[model samples]
Target chain A: MSAFNESFRFGIRNIRKRPYRSFCLVLAAVIGSYALFVGLALKASLNNGIGRMQERMGADLMIVPESSEIEARNILLTGEPEFFYMDVAVATAAAEIEGVECATSQFYFTSLSSDCCSTRVQLIAFDPDTDFVIGPWIDERVTSDVSNGSVIIGSEVTPLSNGKVKFYGNEYSVAGKLGETATGLDHSVFMSRDTMHGILNDAKDKGYQFLNPEDDGAWVSTVLLRVSDDADITAVEKEIYNRAGGIRFIETDKLISDVAVKLGSVENIINVTLTVLLVFSFLTMILFFSVIFHERKKEFAVLRILGTSSRRICFFSLTEGITIGAAGGIIGLVLGILTVFPFNHYIENSLDVPYLMPSVAAVILYGMIGVLVTTLFGSLSSFLSTLSLAHAETYYTMRTGE
Target chain B: MAFLEAQKLVKEYNRRGKTFRAVDDIDFTIEPGDFVMIEGESGSGKTTFLNLLTGLTDPTSGAVIIDGRSLKETGDKEISKIRNQKIKYIPQGESLLSALTVRENILFPFTIGGLERPSEERLLEVSDKLGITDLLDEYPSDLSGGEMRRATIARAVINKPSLIIADEPTGSLDSANTFKVMEIFRDIASEGTAVIVVTHQKETLGYATRVLEMDQGSLKEVV
Candidate 1:
């Protein structure tokens, strides 16, 4: 065991003896590991982003005013609030359709330029009794109802220090805050039908002319639909289109699935690039060690003359490889994290896709796996490089004439 | 019985379908405290002979017996142990490990032998004897040829092995360093270890108790 200690010490000294050669070996590992980590991290974040986007969209089909498809998509995708209205009678017609599970109406309101609001916010109102999305989340986070004078805010919304917010010059209780969905929903707030109408009345009293659902023939902005389990969503969407003229049926599920397919192609390209880098770096490390061992043949021969076994010599090589791999792996992981965390917004915007970091558990598990695999590669490289010495005859090795 | 003996030891090699003897059937013996010098021309097989005797290479036929144990009968690991604990080989030119400092190189035998490191006092004694005490911290690249040769000798003797085999130990040294190294070997042999030196230097014969000549893969004692 002490012999092993001495050999390990000698292995470290060997690496220190040739700085440039050692650096080249370590850098090969670093580049491979860095590429792998960054690719995996981005893939994980994109996957998570896809999930959140799907959850934030929470509707099987959305009915919007005719010729407002682009405007509706822009509002949901970018959170740049817009109000385009269709008659409230659209909800009653959709709910009466066969295979329609339930239908809910929502009013879109923006407070960016309204003097009655304390700050800019996208305020969306749903019928508390008929809503499917946002209601359950509010129930889980807070016990109170989103009734006459209270509102549920998304994670990105800010309330006063005392948990109150002023909208339309009226003070409302901030009932709860939503969890992050990594989507535009995070920047929007929810209110019940009566509370939203009361805010609209206050704004109207202040001389605002936004459409009012209570006015006969006035329109609500959107009607969300939940299709029955037994019904094909496409069939129901077609039925809704036939029965309800002057409204566009947007299947939110199809939107998510389409974006998912496009993101998968980007992921494939990254995977291919990562595979090439891994192979190149792995081969480079093997070649580096092979040449180093060949150059050190005479040094190893001298050790054998001093009665050191070939096994010990091979062990020295293995130690050097593992050391280089571990050091390189740690450096690579840190670099990957630093590059991703601070510049994630840039990556997401460049790719025109949503991206969220993976959970802490996933990051740790993946990081460990990366380090372990690279270390094993390093060990295998050393083993292949030193196979000749492991089986060499001491006489021939010594006679090689160093 | 001799302290170390070779009974008709032979080593042969095949090259391009022809077999030739590197060390032909030869019998030799030396007692503890003996200082033996072997002189030969290039390719005369003096180095091969030393390799055979020390178990560095397997004999094609016949066998070597050290302290009554046949080297041919021992396993590879056992042979390595025998080599580590009983024999030390110092090869020609630049044998010191370049990565290790002089002191670490001298302590290397114990490391390979799996023995506890020798105390610094004993190490200083050996280094002082070889006049390398002041050069312990220096790496092999920093040492002169004579200093490296002396350091190699210190490494070989640090384990206090029963047999010391050196192949052209002073081949790269100046006359002053060569004479000084031979004197160190002479003193080591006086301490009761059998010392065998293979060299072409006629001046080295002065330190030997017995001198042998190698001609055509065979050994004959002259003095």
Candidate 2:
């Protein structure tokens, strides 16, 4: 062990002697690993954020769409045909099934109101007293009217003293904004049932109704029903069809398949890219160590003449490489991950997403893996260099006498 | 038994298919405390002869026995053990690891040879003996040729090996530093370690108890 320390000191001394070479080797490892680390971190954060949203989709029951071509989240966010106003009359009858609970109806809309907002604004409506499904989603905004003058806005809703938005060239006050849904719901404005009716009716008079809400006559998107908590949802779904009428019942969650596919695609690309980067890093380390040994050929030979064994010299050589690699990996991991906090803002704003901060244990685990793998790669490269050259002879050195 | 012995030591080098015999049938021995100077013109196989005794290069035929083990028969590992435990070789100019501080350079052989750990007391002892005590913190590049040589000598003796081999140990020094280095070697040999020096200067003969002159790979008593 003491012999090892001595040689390690010697190794470090040699590296310090050539400051340029040492700087270059460490710099290459840091930049490459940092790039890879940052990419992987962003991808993981996205996956985690999507997972939470999917759970909100109601994990067990499959969401069935009236049509399968469009995205489910899009349907939930804006009642597209894919999300049928599921025959609102079916809700009252569907609740009478043996295992069924009370059922309620809701309407999701992506419409431009005379409310000055240029981006599409999301809106939803539920019977203020009866809609148990939207209960958890409702905020602390206390108002008695689910009518023309009452609105529960999303977190990003701009507030004003008077209710007026110049959408379709008229005025409306954003009654309130809901807590951030991490869904684009931040840009959404909710209206009392009467307010939504007024807006839609006005559109119809203007011959500007894009969706035929009268298809169901009292148009509502998917209905949410409370089942006996213990009752199997799949069985209840079947019973509802048999007892009431043949209708497709979907669990809220099955709608997130698009997010899942998006996540998977991103993961695949990142993994492939990471694998290539790791290989390149290995090669870079190998090239760096080889050049180091080449330059210090004389010094190593001198050590051998002083009586160091081949195995000892090789061990000493690898130790130096690993030290540098480990340092670079840690520095890269820390610098690469600091963006998580900054990303908190981005996800909140643009992705309409929120992510739990990575825990201390998690970040530590990631750092450990990063440093270990990097060091192993460096060590392997140093070992390969050792294998190709005889550690003892300093043959070239003795010949040139340099 | 001689403290160090090399009998009919033959070393050959193969270049493309032709084998060049560098050390040809050289028979030599040194008793304990003997200061034997081996002199030769350049290319007379003087360096090869040092390499043979030091086990840096192996002889193709014959044997070198140091402290009773044959350099030819023992594995390279065991040869190193003998070299580090019994003999120390100081190669020509540029002998030290230039990057290490003077004390570190002096301790290099001690540590690499697996001889002993260094303590401040021992470091100061060796440094003071070679008159390089104040230079312990300085690097080889900062020193004159004489200082480097003295530092190398301090390192060679730190392990206190049974034999000291100086190959052109005084090459870069003036007559003053050269004699200063020779005086240290003579003092070390007086303390019972055999010292072998390879040099061309006749003035260096004063420090040697015995001298063998090498001419084209052969040795004989001179002066």
Candidate 3:
């Protein structure tokens, strides 16, 4: 047999001899690694959810009424319907800005306030001619355009029938359902401006004067603007703020920064807990191996007398440690992957926050790294335990033999 | 030149601020095919002298030379290589690794030296010679004291090293097994390997070509 094979066999045999001790060490590693995996997966899923939100937003700057900027963002983050509107003329004015590529207007309307509406759902309306964000996405999901009386639903929007959703006593045919973005958009319904106008007119006929379409000052909730590739977004933002006439420009980057700031304490808690767990596992391994090495001093001394090099003896111990640690790591990773990933929806629901899991490949890579680090720590512990043996006198150990 | 030589060897221990000499200026030599035995009372430093000769412990004042190489002149790797290739040591008591089977214990020298383990025929030959062929698959815990001693001796000779230093190879064995172990060492020495055994049993000294008695860290030849 090869030298490595021989040493590995000896290491395995030693571990088998003390199954309880080995089990405790491995259990410590598993707990540490499992904690790390869960933390990383949660972090990755949250980041992925944020990424999808940013992608779906597809706007460099959003213009809303200066008084309702916070409420507009709240409406986009949570599907909680609220009455917030700015002049529809803001879309045309924002389109005239120097660095603005395209400006699209969105209308937020709730069908749930009307007792005549069948389902309590937040309704979003976009102009097919001017919309650049949700329009292209809808096109990718469906072959036909959203015609006069039809609608497209978000992935989370559940209609009573396959082809129609009830809105203000009118049934609109469902064009298609969007893929899950794990964002507020998943809970909102999308239609053209004409359809939104029809819904409002129908609500007006039913005596809801709060949202009449033909009223003197008609309004759109928000104006989504894209910046040109050659233009500096910060400069455009500054200029838009300067030219803002009773409206505010909220940059897309600010939304993410806001969420991070809001959840910073939770993130810090997770990170600190993970760091403590990792350190505890490492120290536990060191202590365990220290005791084991002290107990096995006579065995190692015999090996030294039997013509084994001190280096080889150290290697043998390290091999045993790494084997146990690696086994624990694998079990931990498999448990995390099987338990934490598939149950991500439950975590999302409990936290009531955005969460999207990373791809399988990314998770596997993280698992590999986790196992490698665990094994490395195990090897480090082994090295530390054998330091005395490296310079010890074999006769002393042999004299104290069992 | 002697096949193995110990020149002015000394070992000292410090306990509670007092220095005690364990092996005091011991000088010894053994040629090939020599079966040398040393007898000493308890705490007379026979094991200490054996440890020094095997390079398992460093001498405080002198060196052990094996095959023209001084143990003091070589680095750890070179010394370990030399020991693996040329010397075998059986320390006092039941030195068998409790975790390993009797067969694994005998093949340990080969594993440590990075040499291929002995083939089945060679292993069977060694095991049969030690009268442990029936117990090859058993752990050391299951073996009798005499059987463990014989197994340790089997491991020592399995590599066919040029020198074997055994400290009390039969100190705890019964007369029958003690005689059996001495005869095996004699046969090993006759095969052209030098053997040095440290023990207090006078009956087993008959198998030795030379016998020495140790007392109070000193050695005198026996007539």
Candidate 4:
């Protein structure tokens, strides 16, 4: 057999001979690699969620009724279905404010969980002429404008076999489907004001009135505003609060920065934890291998007397380390996948933040990196102990016989 | 020419800031087919002299030459290669690796030296000569003391080294096994390989062509 094969066989036999020691080393690597995989996957998922949120919320400032501010934020972040209305005049006044580049209004409605709808979901109606937020998204998916009798579905919503969805005794044709935004928006449906009005009239015919008795259909839930490029966001926010009275102004940048701060705290915790785990694993491996080599000093001395070079002894030691590390790392990654992916929704809910898993390719890359680092640490730890043992005086070591 | 030579060899040790000699200025030579035995009292440095001869320890002030090259001028890797290829040192007690079978332990020298494995017939022949052919597949733990000793001797000769240096090879064996091991060494030396045995057992002197004694860190020939 080849030299490498011989060395490898010898190393494997040694590992089998000392199963308890090898297990301890492998356990160290497993803990380190598991932490690495889970921590990196979570960090990437939160960052992806934040990026998606920033991109999807195209409005610079959103003006909602003061009482519905928290509700609106929850709807945007969590996709919880809610409905509130203010005067349609809020959109007109906000549009007339200085530094306001454009203004559009969205009407919010929640469908009942009964048979009249496919599922309980948020229905958001946008004004086609002035919309800047949902319009671009619609244009990307559909070949033409969404007609009055058609609706655009979010990624999570399921349409019927006929490509239609029912709400409050009315069925609308499905126009197109939007990609995942990893926010409450993924569970929302988008339509034109005309389609929304038709739904409301149909609801009213069933004696379910969503708007105030005096308002008829002249109501809007929130007005989305895009400020001019050179305008200060804070200034625009104040102007909107002043011009559109009895409203709460939500600055998109502030909202994003707040989430980013939360994300930073989570990342710091993960970094500190990963650092602690890796350091602990590395030191434990060094200590274990040191003790193990010391106990086997006689064995090494015998090899030396049998004409084995110190370098070859070291190589054999490292091969054993690599085998232990690789086995542990692969097992840890498999466990990480099982723990992180299957409970991703639970993790997001418990954290109460935006959490979107990264792409498959990114996940695979992270796994590879984790295994490489684990193997490096394992081999490096063995090198320190083996170097001294390999170069020790063979006569003294054999005579001492630890 | 001498198959192995040591010139003006000296070995010293420092204990608690005081220096003492283990082997002092000992010059020795052995030719092919020579079975030389050195008898010494405990702590008389017979093992240290053997260590120096095998290049396992560097002399304090002199040199050991194997075949033609001086050990002092040999690099560590080259010395290891020489040890693997040309010399085999069988230390006292159980030296078989516990992790390998008797067969693997015997073949370890060839494997580590990157030499092609000896044919199965040669392996069986060596083991059969050492009376360990039946124990080839057993681990060291499963072998008795005498069986383990024979396995070590088998490993030492498997590489066909020019010289064999055994330190107290029968230190822990019964009389029957001890005489059996000594007869094997006598047979090996008769085939033109030089042999050196260090022992306190006077009975083993019967197999030696030349006998020496070590006393107070020095050697003197015995008639």
What would the per-residue lDDT of candidate 4 be over residues A1-402, giving only the tens digit for each residue?
777788789889998999999999999988888889998999999999999889888899998998998899888888889998888888888888788998999999888788777788999988888999988877777765676578999877888777889988888888889977778888899888778878888777777778853454578999999999998878877766676678888888888898889889988988999999989888988899889888888898888888888888899899888887887788778888997899988888777677889999999987987788788888898888899888877898887764
Clashing residue pairs in candidate 4 (N, C-alpha, C atoms within 3 angstroms):
A79-A184
Q: After superposition, how far is residue B119 of candidate 2 from its true place, in Å?
A: 7.3
DockQ of each: 0.58, 0.35, 0.55, 0.75
- Chain A TM-score compared with the true chain A, each model in order: 0.85, 0.66, 0.78, 0.92
lDDT of 4 by residue, B1-223 (tens): 8999999999999999999999988999999999999998999999899989888888898889988889999888988998888888998777999899999899889888888888999899888877889899999999998889889988887756799999999887888879988888898899888999998899889999999999878999994
Q: Model 1 chain A — which ten-residue stretch has the worst lDDT?
A: A209-218
Tens-digit lDDT track of model 3 for B119-184: 898888888877899999999889998898889988988867788888888877788778877887
Residue A77 error for model 3, in Å? 2.8
On DockQ, the candidate that comes out on top is 4
Q: TM-score ranking from best to worst?
A: 4, 1, 3, 2
Candidate achieving the largest lDDT: 4
Candidate 2 lDDT score at position A198: 64
TM-score per prediction, in order, is 0.89, 0.73, 0.83, 0.94
Local distance difference test, candidate 4 = 0.87
Question: Candidate 2, which segments miss by more than 4 Å at Cα?
Answer: A1-15, A46-105, A109-123, A126-217, A221-265, A344-362, A386-390, A394-401, B72-78, B112-131
